[model samples]
Target: MLLIHQLPPKPDYFRVKIWRRLQTIGAIAIKNSVYVLPFNDEAMEDFQWLRREITAGGGEATVCRASFVDGMSDRQMEAFRPLADHGAASERLPGTGKAPMNKRGRTWITRPDVHVDRIASAWLIRRFIDPKARFAFGEPKAGMVRFDRFDGDYTYEGDRCTFETLLKRFGLDKDSGLRAIGEMVHDLDCKDGKFERHETPGFERMIAGVVKRNPKDDARIARGAELLDTLYESFPAAQQRSRSH
Candidate 1:
C-alpha cells in the first residue's frame, strides 16, 4: 500500500514524479494519493525509495503491507496481470503471517564457493520466497531443493541461470525489474553473451570482494543479499529504459 501527501497545492513536478515512480513499479492508484502493489521485496523497496523522495520534496509518504484488501472492481484488478496460478494446492498454504510449505524445514543445497547465480538465488529464496529457508553447500540430498548445480531440479536449462529457473517456476517472472536482474545474473553466471547491463561488472566485483573478505558461505550470502537489495532498487530505472527500446 502507498500513502502520499504534499504541502497543499502540491507542486506539479513532485506530483508527476510520484506518479511516474509508482507507474514504473506497476502500482495501481486506488485513490488520490494512494496506490497499491502486491507484497514483495521489489514493491517494498519501491515504496521506500518513493517515501524518501516524497520527504525530500517536502511531502509525506508511508508504505505498508496489508493482510487483506477488498473492494476492487474488475477494472481496478486489471492493473496487474495475473502472476501465478493459485491452483487447488494453494488452498493448503498456511494462513497469513505463516511460512509456506516450501519454506518450512526445507534445506536448499548448492555448490560450495558460491558465486553470482548461487548467491543471488539464495538471496531470492530468503527475501521473497522463504523467510525460514536454510542453505547448504554440497550435493543434493534425498529431499533438497538444489540450484545452480548439475542434476538439480531447478538448474540451468540452456542459457538461463538457476535464479531465472526459480523465478519462472515460482511464477515471479511478472516483475519486469526482476526479469532484468535475472538477465544480469544469467549473463554473469554463464557469460554466454546474453545480457550486458552497465552495472554488471561493478556488481560482480562487489560480490567477489564480499566473497574474498567473508569466507563463510552464510556470511557471503548475507552480504550478497544486501548488495542485491541495492541492485533491485536501481532496476526500476532500467525497467523504463527497456520499455522504451
Candidate 2:
C-alpha cells in the first residue's frame, strides 16, 4: 500500500507546485484537494518541501499517512532498481506526468493490452527459441515471475494472440491455484488498461507489486519453461499481500 496525505489550503499556483513535486517522486492524487503519496523518506521530504511552499504562500498544510495507500512494502522498494535500470523508465523523473520516462523505454511492454501476449511470448521465445534470453525483449528474470493465469475472467484468458495456445488447448482452467495468481496479475498487469490521466506513474507501482508479491522461483522460463510446467500450476501470493497492505 502507498501512504498519502491531505494538503492544506494554498494558492492554486503553490498547490500545483507541490502536486508536481510529489508526483515527481511517484505520488498519486486520489482527491483534487488531497494528493495521495507514498510513505517514505523521499515522500516525507517532498511533503516537508510542500509544507514550506504552502507556508511561504501563507496557506495551511497537512501531511498524514494514508491508510489505504500511504506507501509500498520493503520488497516493492527493491523493484525500483530494475525499473530504473531500464533507460526509458528512468526518464519519467523530475517532470510532469504525461509521458513515459523515456521514448525508447520499454514501459508500454507491460501494458494490460499487451500483458497476456508479453508473458506467453517471453516464455515461449526465451525457453524454446531464444533460451538464455539472448534475444532480449523483457526484463530479466531476477525479481519477477511470468505466466498467464486466471484473474476474474479477463486475465484467465492467457495469451490471446499467441501462436502457442496456453489456455483452452492447454486446459489451464482445471488448475486450482491458477485463479488467485491470475487476479493479482490481472490487477497488476492492466494497471494501464483503465489508467486515468493522474495514474500514469502507476506502472512503477504495479511492477513493484509483481516483483514483491511473486514467490521467488528458479529456472521458470528460460530453462525450457519447464519450471512453469510445474510451478505455474499454483497462483502467486500477491492478492493476500496486497489485501494486508
Candidate 3:
C-alpha cells in the first residue's frame, strides 16, 4: 500500500502529525511524500485513515496499491513484511535471526526515533546484558538482532513494555531499582497509568527533553542512559520503597 500525500503548507503541525501517524503504522518512506506498507487488511485500513486525514487537512492525498519492478530491490521489499513474520519459527529463539542469548559485542537493531521504552531498554542492555553492545536503527536485516519491536527477541509481551521484557528475560528482574524503573517506563510507554509512580511525571518530562534536544539516536541513548543511571541510584528496591510508603 502506498500513501502519497501533500499537506497544506500553512499548518506545520499537521504535517508532523501525519508523519507520526505514518510512523505508528510502520510505513516506510521511499520519498518525502511517498510512504509504503505491506498490503494487508490492517495496512490498507491505516492508509485509508491517513488518506482521509490528509484530505481533510486541505491537502491532496492518494492511497493505492503499488508494485516496484525497477527502483526497489528484493531485499528492500522484504522490509514490508508484516511485523509478526519478522521473527523466526524456532521455539527456543524468538528473533528474526539467531544470536546467542548472552552474546556480547552484537549490534541491537530497533525501530527509529527512540523513545522512553527504547531508551530504557537500551540502558538495561548495556548496563546489565552487554556492556559493549552496539545499537542500530532500521528494519530487521538478516543476522541482526532486534528488540522493542514486534517479534523481537525482547519486545512487548502482553502489557509489558520492552524494558520490562528485557528485565525478565535477562534475569535482572530481581533488582529493585531496575524493577522500579521498569514500572515507570511501563506506565509512560503503555500509557495505562498502571504504576502511577510519583516520579513518572518528572521522568516523562526529562525523557521528552532528551528526545527534543538530541536528534541522533546515539545521542539520545547517551543522554537517556545518564538519566536512567541517576534514576536507578535514587530508587531503592521496589519492596523497600513499598514498605516505607
lDDT for 4 (candidate 1): 49
lDDT of each: 0.65, 0.36, 0.74
Candidate 1 achieves a global lDDT of: 0.65
| Model 3, position 174: C-alpha lDDT score | 87
lDDT of 2: 0.36
Show model 3 residue runs off by greater than 4 Å.
1-100, 237-245
How are the candidates ranked when ordered by TM-score, highest leading?
3, 1, 2
Candidate 1's residue-wise lDDT over 104-158, tens digit each?
5578888677877788999888877877888998767777876655445666543
- Candidate 3 lDDT, tens digit per residue, 1-245? 78898889978877776775565556788899998876665566567656766776689989999888677654565576434321111111122222346668788998778888899999989988889999998778776668875446777654467787788777778888998899998877755577899989999999999999999999999999999888887766744755876
Put the candidates in lDDT order, highest first. 3, 1, 2
Which number leads on TM-score? 3
Residue 22 alpha-carbon offset, candidate 3, angstroms = 15
